[model samples]
Each structure stands twice: as C-alpha cells, then as structure tokens.
Target chain A: MLEGELLGVFALTWQAAVMLGLGGLLIYLGIAKEVEPVLLVPIGTGVILANVPLGGLTEPGGLFAVLRAAGIDTELFPLLIFIGVGAMIDFGSLLERPYTVFLGAAAQFGIFGTFFLAYFLGDGGLRLFDFSFTDAISIGIIGSADGPTSIYVATMLGSKYTPAIVVAAYSYMALVPIIQPPIMRALTTEAERRLAMPTRAQRVSRRTRVLFPILSILVVGLIAPKATPLIGTLMFGNLLRESGVVERLSRAAQNEMANIVTILLGLTVGGMMTARDFLRPETIMIYVMGVVAFALGTAAGLMLGKVMYLASGRRINPLIGAAGISAFPMCARVVQRVGLEANPHNHLLMHAAGANTAGQIASVVAGGAALVLVPFFA
Target chain B: MAEHVVEAPAPGKILRVHVEEGKPVAAGDRLCVLEALKMELPMVAPVGGTVKALHMSPGQTVEAGDPLAVIEASP
Candidate 1:
C-alpha cells in the first residue's frame, strides 16, 4: 500500500510537461512581454500547479475545481469582475459624445459575423472545427472585446469552449496593439487618418455621472433581460462609485478584491488546460477565429465611424470609431496614438474613450442578445 | 441620496472654484469653461439665485447632454 501511494504521488500526466511550458510562457508574457500580467500571472501559476506531477489539486475537490465549482460554475466570479471593471471605466468619455454609442454598436457586428463564420466552418457545413452552434456563438463573442461578457456568455450558454473563449477574449485584448494598427491603416488613407476632430469641452456633472449608470441599467435590462447579470453587476459597481456611499467597498472591489480574484481566476482558468483539451485542430481554428473576429469588429466600427464622420461634416475622427470594441483603454489609446501620428495636434483619446467605454455596455448587450438568439438559431 | 437635474452648458476643462460648498450665488456669473474639440467655451450661472452645487472637477471628462454644474434655481 505504501509503495502504491508513493507511485500514485509521482505518476506523471503526459500533458503535465506541456502545461508547465504553457504556464512558463504565460509568466513570460506577463513579466517580459507586459501582457495583462494582472490576469496572466495568476493563471500561469495555476497552470503550473495544475499540471505538476500528481498535484491532485485539480482532482475531485481540488483547489482549482473548487474555485470553478463555487465561483465560475455559479457564474459569480465574472459578475464580480464586472464590478471592478465598471468602477474602472469612465463613461463620461462616452456620454460626452453620445453618438459614439453607434460606434460601439457597429463594433459588435463582428460578434454576430464571426458566429456565422464559425457556424459555417463547424456544424453549418464544412465541419472542419469541433464547435457546436452554441460553442461557435460563444467563441465568436470574443470579438466583443469584453472579458466578463465573454466568460459570462460562455458560462451561461453551457459551451465546452468556455476556457478557450475566455483565453481568446483576454489574449486578444492584449494583442490589440498587434491586431488593430495594420487594419486601421489599411482601411484609411494617411490624409483621412490625419483629419483632425473638433475639440469639445469636458464637463460631466456628478448628477449625469450618477444618473448615467442607473439609466443605462434600466434601458439595457429592459431591452435584453439576459444581459441583466452582466449589466447589473457592472452598473452596481458604477453606482457604488458614483453614489459615494460605498467608497470602501468600491475601493476594495476596484483594487484589492479585484486583484485577489484576478489571481485566483487566472490560475483556475489555466488549470482547465490539459494537453488533450488545448492541443487540437479545433484549438488552432479558435485562435484564428479570435483574430478574425477582432478584425471584423474593427472594420465594422470604422465603417460606422465613417458614416458619422461624413454626417457630422468631418467633425468626428473615424479612427476613434475603431475604439468602440471592448478592449477598453488599450483600444482608446491606440486610436489616440494613431490619430496623433496623422496630425500632431489631433486629440482623440477622449472621443475614442467614449466609444471604448460605450463598447463595454454594448458588448454586454450583445452577449445577452446572443444568449437569447443563438439557441433558436442553433 | 436623490439625483438632481442639470444641463451641459458650454464645454471646457474645469478650472478653479468660485463658490464654496453649501453657499449661495445668482445666475450669469462664471461657472466652468466648456472646452470641446479643442476650444475653450465659458459658461455662466444659469437661472441661479443661489449655488446648489458644482458636479465636476478640473481635468474631468464631459459632453453635451452631460450636466456640468447645478444650481438650486430657487432662493
């Protein structure tokens, strides 16, 4: 019995080595490549632990499984993460330029478009990938550029592709730098990119700030009830921040609580990756679809932005429209940087930020819409 | 707390404070500057007998429908 127990302790899982390497890569990406360390670091550590020889941690009642069961399976973790993200976002950047909301809507087309493509590639016809209609829909939502919505929708839809969807969501978010610029340049001429937008004054009232979230929650909740979980958590966090009553909780959610959860969530996510689960033809397809989804989202947003630019008599920067996807500050920063590259005096951050923040809200709504629609379509 | 209603009157970065907290002021005086699309737009107190409150700060972001500073509109 003693010998058997010892043997069990060290018995190597074949994918353990591969998982360890993946973990190390995540760590390197976080530390050296500076790619979303807040999440990747914890996830990387979790991957390493889960893959270790006979860790038993991911076995029945193991640490990662427990986290998944208690938090993820219950859909609690992503909801909580939304609170932190809500607190971090500044909607004034969006509300000031209300029309940017359209850009937000435009960017979401990629979610549906990719869903269509993934479907055709999977059970729809070619049958090249392992995605069921539900999984394809969930995977395509990675285009929303939203972290929580991707996880939330994947969880709710009961898609086996949840881990890959989440990874694709977060990873593509980090890759915004690599994915967006070439597309933006390819779409617009240097002169068009150089076109300067009118500078608008910044003035958000505390009342508007407070009212915005409340109104948004009501509107979106009424429009798409499935989105309530995501929108509610997000608005609740914003309400806390704007209401000024729950400063301590908001601070904790935005800082410490978010930090702790990120670490745990990241690791748990990584734990889901066994070699069999990750290394497949379908996995490669998922990665490809993720990039395509982001690209389509960018193109759709820019197209709508062009309409806005023309309608507004060239008052709006088309580049700012690209920021309407869910990548948040990164997308907004990219738009601003690119705008400046065209014209040194060009300032698009505030405008891009407005669209980027709006993208957060729109993506949630899209997720909710997907949850409602995909079942019927499937 | 209940929400108060207000409007975005010009656009500008909030500069310095004119009225103190829990103070009274009339309309048509200087509020914050409305800076939009790179131009500084100044705003005056609108229909104000006393200052109810100011809702923004320097370097805060805002827009057209966004409320800038609120006034009691009643003495």
Candidate 2:
C-alpha cells in the first residue's frame, strides 16, 4: 500500500507504458532520422510528460490542458502558424505560372476521396467504426498535407480524433519524400520525366506581388467564407512580406512568432495523445486513410500533369504535377530530384515551386470547403 | 566571335562556380550550382563556347536574368 501510494511505477498501466515507448520512438525518429525534428521533438517530450503516472500534465487545469485550451481548442495556434508560413512563402513562381493553380485544385480530390471512404466505412454505411460526419472530414483533412490546415479543419469540425488526425498529418507530411517517388516513377514514362521546362518565365511585377495576397483573400473569401480566417491570416502575412514596407513585421511572423507557436502547438498535440485515446482501432484506420489520401492526391495531380504535358506538346514535365499536394517546398524538391534522376539536364524546380505554392492556396480553400459542406451533408 | 551571355534562371545564391573565365565548355556542361528554396539547381552552359567572363562568384546572390557568365563561340 505504501509502495503503491509512493511510487508512480505501481500505478503505471500497460497502456501508459506503451505510450511512453511510442513517445520514445517519436523522439528517435526526430533526432536520429531528422524527420521534422522541430515539431516531433517537442511533441515527443510532451507525450512522455503526459504519460508519466501522477504527472497529471494532461489532467484538468494542468499545463497541457491550459495550452490546449488556449491554442488548439481556440484554433489560434494553427492560424498563427499560417501567418509564419505565408511570410516564408514566395509566390513569385506561382505568379509566373498561374496555370498551375489547376494542379493544386486537382490534388484536393484526395481529401474528398478519403472522406467518402471513411464515411462509407463508418456511420454513413458499413457502420464498421464510429466515424461520424465530422470525424470523417477530420480524417480526410490529413490529405491536406499541410499541418496547420489539418489542425484548423479538425478543430473547427470538432472531431473526436483530432490527436490522431494531427499525428497522421504531420507524420505523412514528413514521409512525402518516400511516399511520392514510387507513384511518380510508375505514372510517368522516362521520356515524360525527362522533359525540360523553360527555365525563364515572365517575371512578376512589384505591383502584382503586392496585389496577390489581397486579391487571393478577396477571391477565396468570397468563394469560401468559412476559410476566411485561415486564408486571411495567411495572406495578411504575405501582404506584410510583399508590401516591402513591413519587413520587420514579416520577419517577426516568419521567425520569432512561428518558432514560439510551433513549440506550444507541438507539445499540446502530443499531450493530447493519451494511450486510452490513441490506442484505438479507429486511430489505426486514420493512419491508413492518411496514406490513401496522400497517394490519391499524388495520383490525381499526376493525371492532370499528364494532360498538361500532352496539351503542351510534351514541353511541360509531368513531374511538376506531383508537386501540387500542398506539402510546400518538399514536394517541389522531390520533383526536382526525380527529374534530375531521369535526366541530368532537366531543371523543374521553378515549375514545381509554382505548382507547390498553388497547392498551398488550394488546400486552404479545400479545407474551407470541407468546413462549409460537411455540416450541410451531416 | 558570337558572344552569349548566360543568365540566372531564378533568384538564388551561387553555391559553386564550376567554370573559370577563359575555360572551354560544351553545351549542357555545368556552369555553376545555385541554391534556391532549399534545393540545389545546377546551372548549365546553353552553348558550346570559350568562357570569356564570369559575373557571378560562389556565395553571391543573384536575381533571375542576372548574368552569370559570358561565353564566346569557339571560332
């Protein structure tokens, strides 16, 4: 009785032990594998802290709970992070090739496709799992490949599986390098991959740069009002960046604010992952659906790329289509690498960056569309 | 001699300059490596020629259309 009262070891459940191990594994992946060490490391530490018996960090009014309430529940952290992301992004490439916006829109099919499958397997049809309308939408958002958008959507929808969804979103995003290459290789012929796009595109004017974020806000907000908050903050940051007069504010958003919020957001997300909540069949299914979402998104993008390739008389590298998944620079880098592998002379970086940035806007719109449409259907 | 000016394809930093002024190069031969958006882009010579002048150096930042090198077609 004394030992039980004094030692946390005596109170530790097998579930908690498993969570501790999982937390350790996340740390290992972050430190050793260098897979998004910035977020993963903080998340891992939070997981360990939350699972420690008697720590109560995740209990009512605890540190994790307070952070979660102030950040995740209020949906402030992800929104703030978007500001940072916008400041970091250079839409010059996208402006040079506005046609790539279709590629961005094409990739969003993954979100809807995964939603349909999740709904069919759950409350909508098979009744295999407890995924309700909102749960399915949250799960579908894992395909957004943008962590902030996934969190914002999942939280806005009030999905019970927010922790699982966020984990899957971040994990799969880091795995973009591994998941995309096989699909890209299988979909494109050697000749298609080797196609070289013109390196020089029309340079965007300073006026166009400054007008882009404002115009995007007006267009996207008018079309998807629900996404206004998400897109608003994002474009606001970009406006600061392109304004040329707000260098200090833009720098703050990109560096100091982004770093601080990332730490809080990562830790809160990890703290939410209690073993009882995370070790469920539905959680496993969410992970599976995440892979499906990414694959489907990649496939859809590639198909459009193929269409564009033929339309352009094979001048457009179909590989650039794969960058339309909103994973930002990572997807663009993958396109460049794969293009190089197929032909050393092919440089697809600028073209891929265009599609990749377009994907960023498209994914935000898709997230807004989901927020608006899911409730009407539910 | 027909002189051709090779320009930067995008805004980035020169990571390495593989050619020196007065050196000969073939079309498609690497001229320098540019780092942009966290990826390395290897800039290549557009025509076979003797390098007449270089406008870029390692670690220098360049904008799109900034001249990186000038090449004179081999007579």
Give RMSD to native, each candidate.
9.7, 1.9
What is the C-alpha lDDT profile of model 1 across A1-378, one tens digit per residue? 566457744566656677789889988999998899888888788878877766778888989889988888888888888999888776777777788899999999989999999989999889988788898898889999887788888888888878878888898999998899999998887877888665555556899999988888899999898999899999988988888888998898799877777877887888877666776778778889999999999999999988887898877778987998989888977886787677654557677878998898999999999988865777
A1-378, model 2: which lDDT tens digit per residue? 788668999989999999999899999999999999998999998899999988889889899999999999999999999999999999999999999999999998889899999999999999999999889999999888999999999999889899989989999999999999999999999999988777678878999999999999999999999999999999999999999998999999999999999999999999999998999999999999999999999889999999999998888888999999999899999999999898776778889999999999999999999988876788
Compute the lDDT of residue A186 as modeled in candidate 2: 99
Q: Please, what are the lDDT tens digits per residue for candidate 1 over residues B14-52?
A: 555466545665655666554553444445564555555
In model 1, what is the error at residue B1, expressed in angstroms? 52
* CAPRI grade of model 1: incorrect
Chain A TM-score per model, please list them. Answer: 0.96, 0.98
Error of 1 at A81 (Å): 0.7
Q: Highest lDDT: give the candidate number.
A: 2
